[model samples]
Target: MSDTLTTIGFDADDTLWHNERFFALTQSHFAELLADHTDHETLMQRLLEAERRNLPHYGFGIKGFTLSMIETAIEVTDGHAPASVIAEILNAGRDMLSHAVELLPHAAEAVEHLRRQYKVIVITKGDLLDQERKLAQSGLRDLFHGIEIVSAKTPEVYARIFNAYGTGADQGMMVGNAMASDVVPMIAAGGWGVHVPHGLSWEIEHAATPEHKRYHEIPDLAHLPKLIETLTQGQINATS
Candidate 1:
């Protein structure tokens, strides 16, 4: 919330609403589906590996994850997984897509508070259709000034977003749960990075804890406004 920070970007999924929890539940179901072929631990490992391998091709979101699960099932069962198992996996993905959007505690309050003082936007990466559907269902969509559903969250991607919004890197702040996709890359692009930890995180989105001076870690969304106030009032330097 430095004086220069005219725009604040938020990550949509876990940062604003309950996302990873659904994935975790779905994963458990997936483990169950493959239990006959392999134990839970090994199936989970295989699924993780499949996800990592498919990321570049399918990108991020439920569709890609569902496909990876199918692929993993095929591999684990030597391409002999039953039609019923494949159907279950597909249904799981559909259910996830249609699941109700539940906002995290204080998410609406935090976004409302920040919107009053800043040009708040959502910069999230995932399947465009699914992300858009979630935003539409979130009931917080109108609170944001803009929404960006991107293919990735690299530094260059962020730089373009900031440029499009007419905010410089130093004049932007990114708040989200993932250190890998949300905080570090945005910080590397010269923006302030605020990390709000979600209880569960996708393994592929994990990264080393950042130690940059411009990086800040807040417990949750409720603490955001105070942190912004501190930065803007010069009570603390953004680079501190």
Candidate 2:
């Protein structure tokens, strides 16, 4: 793939390590805290609604989620969310912030392999400090050529980052778990988009898959190297 692909970007959260799972667990904790006020299903729906409303204001990360939980708590309980509940919510957010980084299966090896052949980078959207901390603990930091903690991953953002860090998005490839943030936008920016699914996904991140030739999906990160080789050979065949 070196002949056609110059850069490879990986999404740092669920794509590399355990991320959404923790969010799921935290949401569970949130539901429990508000059990007296609302049922689990109803609380989750309301929490999701608050997140949608506040995303533009707070952006993505534990801080935003914590605020959304508090907002939902207030709304569910008729604007009388308890001080102790708020305190526990803050505590849960802190726990999420300080959670240990656990690498996904084959995450390290896949990144190491790709970096040897391409300009491997991390293109993720989250709180900057938390992202930096996670990278520092991930043990895969040095394997990357660059780390991008974007507020959001849009087509323009992908284009700019790829051009600034490598050649351009056209010769770039991005692998991540979020179709909306990672795969679709990169494809829109004229790069190859590879989807690597995780067991848990946030509903807000869902989008209809783009019907594009450059889009591909792998069962796991371990398959990335082989996919690149196949694409590389196909590129050679087409050009020759």
TM per candidate comes to 0.95, 0.98
Q: How high is the CA lDDT of each candidate model?
A: 0.91, 0.93
Position 59, candidate 2: lDDT: 97
lDDT of 2 by residue, 192-211 (tens): 99999899999999988889
Q: Please report the TM-score between candidate 2 and the true structure.
A: 0.98
Which pairs in model 2 have colliding backbones?
none
Pick by lDDT: which candidate is best?
2
lDDT of 2: 0.93
The reply for model 2, stretches above 4 Å from the true place, is 1-3
